[model samples]
Target: MWLPLLVKRLNQVDMQKKGLQLTAEEIYDINNASLKDAIVQFGGFCTGEFISKEGLLLTNHHCGYDAIAARSTPQADYLTNGFWAASRDKELSNPGLFVDILVRMEDVTGKVLEGINAQTPEAERAKLVSERMKALAAEAKGPENYVTYVRDFFAGNEFYLFVYERYNDVRLVGTPPNAIGKFGGDTDNWMWPRQTGDFSMFRVYADANNKPAAYSPNNKPYQPKKHLPINIGGVEEGDFSMVFGFPGRTQRFMTSEGLKLAVETSNPARVKLRGKRLEILKADMDKSDAVRLKYASEYASVSNYWKYFQGQNAGVKRMKTVEGKVENEAKYNQWASADANRKAMYGNVLADINKGYADQKEYTLSQVYLGEAALAPAAAKFALNFVPLQKALKENKADDIKKATDAIKEASKEYFEGFNVPTDEKLFAAMYQMYYNDVPKSQHPDIFKTVETKYKGNWNKFAAEAYKKTFLTSPEKLNAFLAKPSLKTLENDLIFKTVNSVYNNYLTNINPKLQAARSSMDKATRLYIAGLREMQSDKVFYPDANSTLRLSYGSVKDYEPRDGVHYSYYTTAQGILEKEDPKDEEFIVPQKLIDLIKAKDFGRYADKNGELPVNFITDNDITGGNSGSPVINGRGELIGLAFDGNWEAMSGDLVYDKDYKRCINVDARYVLFVIDKFAGAGHLVNEMTLVTTPSPNASTASTSAEAAKADVLENVKPAVDSKTKVKIKKEERKAKAKMKK
Candidate 1:
């Protein structure tokens, strides 16, 4: 349902019919400042949009969760007590956090595929394409600081070149406390009727010339080419909505066998492994706030996907997605057999895919267990860092040894900061045992034999002894070894040996098989997709998301999750109060918010019913990296922030269920209310251009108090002075005049 921006121009007429006000050029013109200029790939994972010329950005609270948690501590406790920087100078800097603004994207498919034909071998074709792409990227990346890369689309059937300007000086502006930002916690995650105010604010800083720069005290806020005007007007049920962002990935083209493997083998294994890890982490976290602070981000991340896999399995079953894929494949086969040319190209595609998946099944599951279980413990994963160090030591290369040692020393500081030995030991015991029991005996690592013979098959006992003997769990010991620089010391370490053996076995035995199977599947899939496009020539084929900028347009709507229950399109503050629990941490509401709700201190942000809108649902197609994407109305104004999809559509990445695929967004009104009234960060609001037109859903109200409030709001001075407003209008007119020519 999501189309790459390149294809948006082709669908411009169709999009206009759906109520889009802006032209395709207006949305993505490289020559003039357009809507794309306002958007950024936040921290290389989520999406964010510029809300002010001074580079004030808006993204989901969860999207900024890790950066916020990293800065939090028991004393400052920014996580519990929200952060608000009253001025630019007061903002906190986040090292290594950066945002990339896409400068432009151009199709380079013909150039990339040059000199490669059907006669070319798969490996040779791939090599040629890689060489061409590298050359094209180098040419595109001139003397500027722009980062250029080529990404394949439609499963290598096409490619596009993306140019981005990355700014490393992004700062946290403001965020509501977890009680507000993560109000429902995991319980309400991916669920409907959510009241979580999930928005967070940040500001991008740059050098004096408004170019990307590293964090510096003297750096000023960036002046973006375009910023979205915030529309406070509430949405109606049927109003046009569009979500634009970098949607991470989707496997809509995945074969039935792939779906079966995911649902039955990979997902369940990951769920079980992460579930155990979470149990241990939560136990320790609950016992102490310090532990919770240390592991909060990790817990959130693990639990998010743990729940996602569960929902995805259930949704896949409920939607009968695998059966549907099988039915589609049957049709594809029938279509392919009708013509000799098609049969020659695609006759083997499905058979190859089925055999490839079957061949890789056990190896894929083994790899999953190897990753999720064998490397589940922080200590085991941390030990991987010393692999290069060991190799350098063996080679007797002092420069490589010194470089590796310095890197480990720096890495150990961060690792030890969050590493809890007791918790990691438990994780090691549980996860290793899971891997040993689940994986076949033939595939077992050499260390499992040691555990069975030396430790009498007692994983806990082996783990305790391993933790005691290994330097990985102790920074002091690690540093001591680094100072001494002994290959024998590292090679003999039990944890290092265990991690190395697991990796070595996989590298020697499993990876080659998996890669070979995957290569066959990849080639078949590319041909299958190309054939499908040819067969269904009348249908518009949108490529699956690959972390590229995309646009999905739809309308605000509601749905029935089941036979008798119909859900509303939007949630309100009243739902927040209804869900609040005095004892439960997840549902606890701040007394300030509770009092404000009870007092009905709703400002101009209130909807027609005099209730504060919390979150709304749209049919916009989205996926993982679409988090914090701006939900824009037909007029091209920011209406909300897209955060999560409905639970009934958890398998959306594999199959988009039109009826159940609802995009959950925190209402822009709620975001503003929390920022302006709750956090007292009106200056951030003043930075944005506020659109106050009444919504289509607004109804006449005759209350005297309402009239008084409206009058006061109208009389308030605009953020921009009258002269500046006139100047802006004149500049806008000049740009339009130039566009006309």
Candidate 2:
């Protein structure tokens, strides 16, 4: 199970018993450099780790998909051909990409709850907590570009403060072509027995003092406090494995009613809407490479969760998770009834939670449809960006108008970069029709009335006319309008009016009731958790994930996913060959990689069986944001990158099933093999510290594996001096520039 680094010391005895070689202080220390220093929150959504002192980072290929796709073009299609920087100067800069390293975390529960009591109203309690959190964060702000924020834990029963140093000058180092990196595609995304080499490399650059700074040509590669040593010694069955990173969110405390709503109402609507959007985008993307590059990131983002919701619903039903929660609540109620004080405190917790969910159920599907359908169109969402500029223009405030206009211009760049006019128009028509058919008539936005009256309920005809007239679809048209600045033009714009009407209706009608229900549910959940903790004092309670740093430890082991259907712990190159199908894009293998596998070009990176390991599974508790997390061995060495979870445990975010929840990881050797052999990026490999020795406590080593260890050590090379190579590259670039002059 996952444990917060804040209280890891408290469980040191248990951790050691589970084969953790490192001390608690070695894992996380405020005054000294520890394992935490090497980990970073990649681009605010995923996790990455520093593998070299020169700040070379390693993360999942999908995590870096957007950055790589953003740099791709028709001629230099990095997404298909892959990218490898031959020298430091050749590395491409990603403008908005940043990585945050944890400096420390502090518990401030008492400070945050200083002026709060049980009698305090929910609204007042929230306001007080917000004010105190702001004050605490402001007090912790530093001159060295440190970011501090306080997050509530255990449903607001406790709070913790996190301080981080954010570096903005991250650059792409290397990546395998999608044929290898994304071999299995969506078909095999959350499945096991996989061989996808899902890894990408990047480097973080900082100012001369190694402090955070914006992008600059003169900035040097960051020197981190620590970097993980790479262990080429392959994993064995039952080997101790630990995954450390920032896991996004988990709803382990969700009541039975909440799960019912997600499974029955919210998830289905989202799946249907996204599935339609994906089909349209895919059809267009297949027509041309340029279109594919344009919508690749968008398609990947939508499809990732589209399949996740489907699996979650099925898994929840199969696992009977809702029924399990109901049973637990009954037990809790019985326990509460045994004591007078407990009865007074927790008697109505379950009832309040159930009632709150019931109250919100009527509006739940409406809210889902609104988000999934009404706001799904790109042009409609883009039009909302002009809201500030419209207000400014109405008031005739030049400064506000200028500020808002500049922001819109900046936002338009990214929007139009991935925007496809025909695709968006199709989405507009399909999404609205879905909304009209699904959402209740009384909950329909005012725009539907206009659709019926002006266009006779023909969403396609309405979308066509709207696209034709609105300036939001094209950058040139939007820029032309922005230059003149007409409030009347914006007020009459069809797309703007439609989005505003839908949003305004939501704000006016649906949000208040939802907020009231949420408030009641939150209070009851907090009380229930507090009571449960008190009752089960011996149980070690770990708070649910909230995009905060966490550590989950388990072992490398196989599973019987079903009776008489046992799966192995790891996969190899042979699996990739067996899965390859030239006709199917998902299984297509590059000829170069296929040849290497056929030739058995397995070097020291291979296992004792003379096979190159690809992906492995561990029962490490992880969820969405844990993607790209480092899978470290007991010796605190990098072994693999956690990329996806098994489909059998898709409901793990709500209820973790120890037997079914498996973390799928790309083996570290596979990542290295792709870089050094496949991509010819040996320089990048030369930047990492490679270790061939096995941990002393490793128990499952065979005589053949022990014999192969010596051969592996002989082939392993020491890391080159990255600082010297970088300095040389800089000098060479300057000389070449002078020669050109």
TM-score of each: 0.93, 0.94
Q: Write the per-residue lDDT of candidate 2 for residues 1-741, one digit (tens) a residue.
A: 444465465667776777778888888888888998999999999999999999999999999999999999999999998999999999999989999999888889999999799889888998999999998888888776479999998999999888999899999998889998898888887887788899899999999998888899999999999999999977887778899999999999898999998999999989999999899999999998988999998899899999999989989998999999889999999999999989998989989999999999989877987778887888888888888988899899999999999999999999998888898899999998998888888888898999999999999999999899999988889999999889989978888888888888888888898988988888899999998898899887889999989998888877767642456678788878777888888888999899889998967788766889999999999998899999998889999999999889999989898789899999999999999888888989998999997644344355565445534433431212211111123333343345446
Model 1: per-residue lDDT, tens digit, 28-123? 888998888999999999999999999999999999988888889899888889999999999989887899999889999999998888999998
Worst 10 residues of 1 by lDDT: 717-726
Model 2 CA lDDT for position 560? 65
Question: Model 2: runs farther than 4 Å from truth?
Answer: 1-4, 695-699, 703-741
Error of 2 at 416 (Å): 0.8
378 Cα displacement, candidate 2 (Å): 1.6
Root-mean-square deviation of every model: 9.4, 10.5
- lDDT of prediction 1: 0.87
In angstroms, give how far residue 46 of model 1 lies from its true place: 0.7
Candidate 2's error at 724, in angstroms? 46
lDDT of 2 at 441: 89
Q: Kindly report which residue pairs in candidate 2 clash with one another.
A: none
